[model samples]
Target: MRPLDPRLLRYAAGARWFFAAGAVLAALQTVLTIAFAWSLSQAIVGVVEGRSLAELRTEILVFAGTTIARLVVTWASGSVSIRGAARVKSELRSRLYRAIGRLGPAWSAGRSSAGLTVLGTRGLDALDDYFGKYLPQLILTVIATPVIVAVMFWQDVLSGVFVVVTLPLIPVFMVLIGWATQSVQRQQWDTLSELSGNYLDVLGGLSTLKSFGRAERQLTRIRVVTERYRVATMKVLRTTFLSGFALELGASLSVALVAVGVGMRLVAGDIGFGPALFVLLLAPEAFLPLRNVGTNFHAAAEGVTASEDVFAILDEAADAADATATAVHPGGGPSSAATAPAGLEFHDVGVSYDGTTVLSGVSARFAPGRVGVLTGPSGSGKSSLISTLLGTVAHDGVLTLDGSPLPSGPGERPWLAWSGQRPGLISGTVADNVSLGEASVDPDRLTRALALAQLDGWDADRECGVAGSLLSGGQAQRVAVARAFYRALRPETRVLVLDEPSSALDHETERRLAASITELAAGGLVVIVASHRRRLRDIADVELALTPAVAKR
Candidate 1:
């Protein structure tokens, strides 16, 4: 990991302010350090020379005052660094969330949600040690170490040379130790993410495992993963302790070298007692910042690793944005215009994944005031087509609305409302889930949408619990469909797409949903339903059948 990542400054504006404040504090502390060392040295020498107490009074007070000021500066520096870290973490997290949203469901489908949860929460929290300790010491090292060494040089050339030569040794040892620490720290972080992901997976599918009499096997699996994580953590801790000891030893030896030189000069009368004393005092101060930096780096290594993960995500988002901007649309024009026709058209649209075609050369159109049903066998590209329409997947050919190309970014497709195979319901009241994106719930629309989805007379205030656990499977599915219905109620919504809306419902409820879909189409909206039910296909004003594309060898 870099001593400081440039991406942190680029992504978190607050980090810039933190650096500024830290530098100011470090400079002030350095000045006070010099003042304190000088005053104390002079006072001690004056007493040894048999000077009167009154003569040494000013020197005594100067050192005392400088000591107090140094304490205040240290406290203030810590406070500033902590607050700055909070702001930076907050900013980075917010940006990370936005980037994920932009990447959309397609990008996230291949990633572990549990791992991301760990990263956004506990992983980023590790930065507390980074900004609070490591960065402050680093700034001090840059601003104070050289200044102290220069002062030593001015007083005694031999002592200054010793400092300059030995200071490099601490950094050299730090580099070697840091490499090992980073390798171990990264392993620990990965293990933690894997543990979180596996644990979440086991929980999510515990019911299925129990049904198959295999739940006990999962316990063993989790135990093994837990042990692996424990071992990884121990390795990281071992590396940290060993690296800390190495840095302390190097700093101690360097300070001793300077101390021995000063002691010899004083014995030989080659330097004044006051100058020798001052050099002796400043020698440790010169090494203090560098030594602290090495110690704090290990503590902050985890945060550095997390930041690297965050930067990778941010870079992916940036690259995706660039690709979106430069990509060519098949229709060769801007997105749908306000005056365009109220219908959707597919011009030989195709989709591929990992160089294997899933959809190819399919053409179709659905006009307003029509119920269009897509029927196909498994692996027939039905979901792929919907993904392309939702702007979650890239496709060949063109999808147009009212004769204009459809926008390829999800955020730009505000006119489309959809419900997928998964309920994806959050913990909230029924009304809250239905009117999710609305600024405020419209009571009339909420009641109508629920009624249209065969949820009429159901309490709007019914709790969904976690992932709609409070509702039955069919009810949760309806709630998801109702959410899409709620969105379709908006005047701006032109198309409503539902994937397997009736898969969990009984025959009677499926018939009612089909009638409701027909009613929606009557309102001059293009309604598309992807399903295998014969009743739904019979009610459609149009039907499009898709076949799986042949893979090229």
Candidate 2:
């Protein structure tokens, strides 16, 4: 997470070899460039001194061969490096996706679809520069530039030291410029991500807002946010272009100085024409890499910003590692009890987000085979309580499950199946949407669960449109319930949580859905629903009325 960390390299353990080989190729190319220039000078000077034609021919052949070798190595390195960088990007993207999948609500609640899409798409794309272009070029510049300058020094110290002294300025300015622009680039990326998230939310809910004549206002807000991001982006771009221009100007001036000095020495007869010409040809290659590093530094600025985002998402408190599994793995800890009586209990528990409290001090108990309903006015802490029990929210007090304090990690103790108050809609058959996260779901179980939610009537093979577009809100809610049913059908399923279970349903449908939920709970499943509707209170084994606070024990 440090600004200067070589994160992409650390993750690219397997592909570093290819990168190293690419660096070698770059060095070889630089060596060949010098060798070719050196050979040409020797041949010409030898001819001028009345050397044999056959010797001249030999030098020419050697120079030609080295040039050819340089080209071959350069070409092969491009191929190998591009493929290797692509491999790194692919693997990193996969890890990112899997990590996000595991993170679930922890990340999803805070991010937007467009933002995540960008993170997965162009955001991950910055790694290509890190590995393919910048890394290989940087390595070659470091390895070959000094050696070339040393050769120039041996040929003529004045020219060698001249380039050597001026050479570091490119990288020096790069560091300075990169440092100056780092914060700005980072801000630009963050603003872009925020814009992406907001845009997705706006588009997703545009229809609803339009029905209430709020679409114009939403668009205005989006434009304001986007313009702000644009200003930030323009500022970063200005700095980036300046860095590149400075590097280019500095390199050009250095090369010009080398050319003028070499020409003067050749005229003075102090250094022979042959060595002087060679220095002139090879001087730019020394500075080219440094200039390139500056260019690459700016080119990869977004990638650097994007990579920072990727790392934050990847490391955002990874699903609090399974404590028992970890404890048992290394030190051989206690065994997991079959009935540890690890039911969830909350006492004086409260939670909040962004400094605004969502849940206040609360006390509750969830026992196996019992049904619990949390009811309150809209914006009350019913849903937050469920999140507290699930450990998705930061809590102020104690929460225990099955007599053991609930593990603070996600997907750990008290395995829960949460059917969110707001269900996801996707393009597919009814069956597909109901079974998005499940692997190899049973058809019979699927049929039963669908029936429980009163969705048995819909044709299973019919297209639901994108996100069950063919279905009405009540129908989608029923399908979502069916999904909860499918998850609960698992033999290991212990706790099933629902939010607004009957929000989309009418009187009769709500009645049926309530009955279905009761049937599930009656069969030893721990069912918890957050609702304000009085209709579901009848079936709840226990009813909890939540407000701003619950008295501490």
Candidate 3:
């Protein structure tokens, strides 16, 4: 049940075919195993009874052929299982990536990059054993065990009784071991996630640690986490080994009991020589798949644990998306004409995070052909207000567009554009970063945007390393501003929002950027800027200041 997490089977539609094929191959292998065992008995009994070598040769060949076929089918089934696992892993990773994107930066801000990384990469890769060995063996146990046992009964009823009685014990022991190892496996997986997150975090802050003269102390922390992980892993391995040994011992004893029964019956002349020998050979075959399943389960437990965590995230994301979808206005909500920007009205609007109210009972209005600046101290919710308007965060009370309730979801408004405090850039040329998937890059418009943001000296073709590392702080800010302008140039863009636009700029550059905001407002777009700088506030047609909410006595 733990191995068969429903979310995996439910979400990975493309990979289901591989599982189906593996089950079919398992059935085929089961048939071949029984057939080979029958032919092997026939060849041995015929030779012992002094039959012609020519007659026995046919049984020998059939046995050999069945053996070869089983080998080939097993190899093919293994290949199919591995390919299916890869496909499932790929599909799950894609779904996770898309879900993370839909959840937006706010949700991601609360999670560790290293933890998510390990979940998507190493955590998923751990499923290889589950799919490739454990699942196929499990299918064989389900399909092949009863059939082989029935065949044993047909050959000799006493030996079949022994197998039937002993088969239940294997699963009984497996369940007991599973109970003990389940918690340990879960603990090991959690430890692994912690280790991965801590190591990546330490590495990211290595420079800060060195500057603060605390770099060497971090080694002790890392070592402690690593040792904890090692201990957890060793505990899982010990339980797995002990469980495997116990199952093997039980299977061996069961086979021996059947062998002794069959041999005693032959000595008493209660069964034919051929039947006795056949039952002896077939007794162990009945338990082989079941024993292998027990052995393989340990290898797959880690993946099952990781899969539970992945499904939990996917489910939460789906619920959030469903909630947002219901909140969306069907008629595309409020829209502005090409010549005028939409008016925005906040009526006692409020926002909260983790039970702490950031903005409460605030009201404001900004209209077309006007610039609105939000002035506030840190943690006074200027950025949160911008996020609310952009539909990134849910808010209580009402926000209206042209005097109607606004749509309540991120990306619900194509007309809105925003530039955040930290500019996010990929590893690409300057033009690539600014154009950002635009089908046609207009040289004139790009040049104008860059000039307005005071980035005219930067080469359009120059490479901007990851997160714009090649550029200085102020230059990166300008690049983000230029991208915002380029987006605002689109015919559908009616509202422009900038958060801390001049935080990295000097007086001259800040003045130039402020001029650009006013120019955007003059062109009939409602422009909103969240900044503390006087240069930006001085240029705004309307200024809204926010204060921290007071606690009631």
Candidate 4:
């Protein structure tokens, strides 16, 4: 990716204002720097010519005032740039998170959780250096470099010509060095992602490894991955140092050439002391921004790599959503919702994984005030069918509401609630997770939902440590049930689907959960459950028995 990809600006806010303000500040600072140098040079010449201290008072005051003003301008510029960059980062992170959520199980199945975690956290944080340092300096370089050179030319054309001619060397060296190291930097990013993924996976499966007496074996694998990542990181750092050295060398040589020209002209009595010193001071300033850019490019490179990955995910999600929408609405018109009496219907429904059909030609009907229990063998695609209804995965055949095809987009299924086989819980209070992403929380409704999920005696304010580690497995499962019931508070939600909600419970608890399902259905909600427990199936108003694709054929 380029240092400033257009897609970043499209998603990030306040970039235009940040860059514009940076340019204005750079111009002001450049003018002040030149004036301070001119004043100092004049003061020195005046003092040497037997002038009194009082005679140079004006020059001294000018120098001090410009110095203070320059400092203030720089501080203000940095403050604005930082806030703008933060705003952009925050907005981009939120958008990426929402896009991932919309992609659902399809994305989860295809992506590495550790890789995505790194990209969202440490990867996005890399932009700090890119914005706080590189971007501001980049603007300064563009504005200050040429203007300073032009002023030096006005003072003494020969010295100005030398600076103008040699100044291009810094950027030229930077471009060459950057071109050579781009591939190495990309490799470093990939290595970091791989290492992060491996470490997370190992940590998650550590208990299993211990049980099988393979923990020691996995240690060696972890060490090898870490060493590889360390080597890749070192290579990136070495490249950065080499590039910085080359830029420094080119800039130093250019400044030295300008100094030599100015000194010779001074010796020949062609230029006065004040103008000579001014030209000399301004010569180095010309290359400073470009040099800084090369130095900060290392940070910029990491951010760019991460950004490429982030944008790729966003783009792919959008394409998938578009395709799903097209499939849902084949006539290129909005899909009509099936009317109330029929509730939800599936006709000749099928699902496939890795090109093999999991479920085929399955038909079922679910109506209001009824509970539909989906029962089948282990590989019969029971969960797959529920995921399709919940809009987590795409499906073949027609799923309709009142004989009208269901809408394709994930957001269009707001009226549907799902509690997956694995309960989704984060580290927060019971109420927090129950009301996750909700705009408001109702105490009475919350209490009722908890009761319905069999979560009695649990405090709403109790902390559910990371993934509900603070709660027992059954308690966590009940919390998932509570979350689904809370979502069912919406008047539009006519269908509730629970996938293996009884998996973590005892037989008695499973009976209680089944009773809750029957109660919700009695209250006029269409409840669909995919479960192996007969206790749950016994309460069903309708039972759909599915078979594997081969058996059906």
Question: Evaluated with lDDT, which candidate comes out highest?
Answer: 1
Models ranked on lDDT: 1, 3, 4, 2
For candidate 4, the clash count comes to 3
RMSD of each: 1.9, 4.6, 3.1, 3.4
Q: What is the lDDT of candidate 4?
A: 0.83
What is the lDDT, from 0 to 100, of the residue 5 in candidate 1? 91
- Measured against the true structure, the TM-scores of the candidates, in listed sequence, are 0.96, 0.84, 0.92, 0.88
| Per-residue lDDT of model 3, residues 1-553, tens digit only | 3647767777788557876897799889989998898899888899888999787888988898998999999899888888988998898888888777777667888998888999999888988988887888888998999999999999888888999999999999889998888989988888888898988888889999999999999889989999999999999999999999999999999999998888888999999988888788888889999999899999998877777778888897889889876653222223333433458877777777767787788878899889999998998899888888776777676677676677665555777778999989889988998988788889888998898788887789988899999999988888988999988877888889999999999999898889888898889888999999999989888999898873432
**Count of clashes, each model:** 0, 11, 0, 3
| Error at 162, model 4, angstroms | 2.3
Q: Which window of 10 residues has the lowest lDDT sum in candidate 3?
A: 328-337
Answer with 2 or 4, whichever has the higher TM-score.
Answer: 4
Spell out the clash pairs found in candidate 3: none
- Candidate 1 wrong stretches, greater than 4 Å: 330-341, 550-553
> What is residue 183's positional error in candidate 4, in angstroms?
2.9
lDDT of each: 0.90, 0.76, 0.85, 0.83
How far does residue 52 in candidate 3 sit from its true spot (Å)? 2.6
- Top-TM-score structure, candidate number: 1
Q: How well is each residue in 1-553 modelled by candidate 4, as lDDT tens digits? A: 4657777777776677777788889889888988888888888889878898899999999989988998998898889777877877787788789888778876578778888999998888888778888888888888888888889889889988888788777778778878866888788888888889888988999999899998899778888888988888888888998898888898899999988888998999988988998888888888898899888888788887887888887787778878876764222221355333467877777776657778777777899889999998998888889877867776777777765677644666777877988878999899999988878888888998898898877799999999999999989999998999888867888889998898999998888878888888887788999988889889988999887775422
TM-score of 3: 0.92
The model with the greater TM-score, 1 or 4, is: 1
lDDT of 2 by residue, 89-185 (tens): 7877887786675664645877677888898898878767765567667777877788889889988999998997888777678778877788888
What local lDDT does model 2 show for residue 201? 86
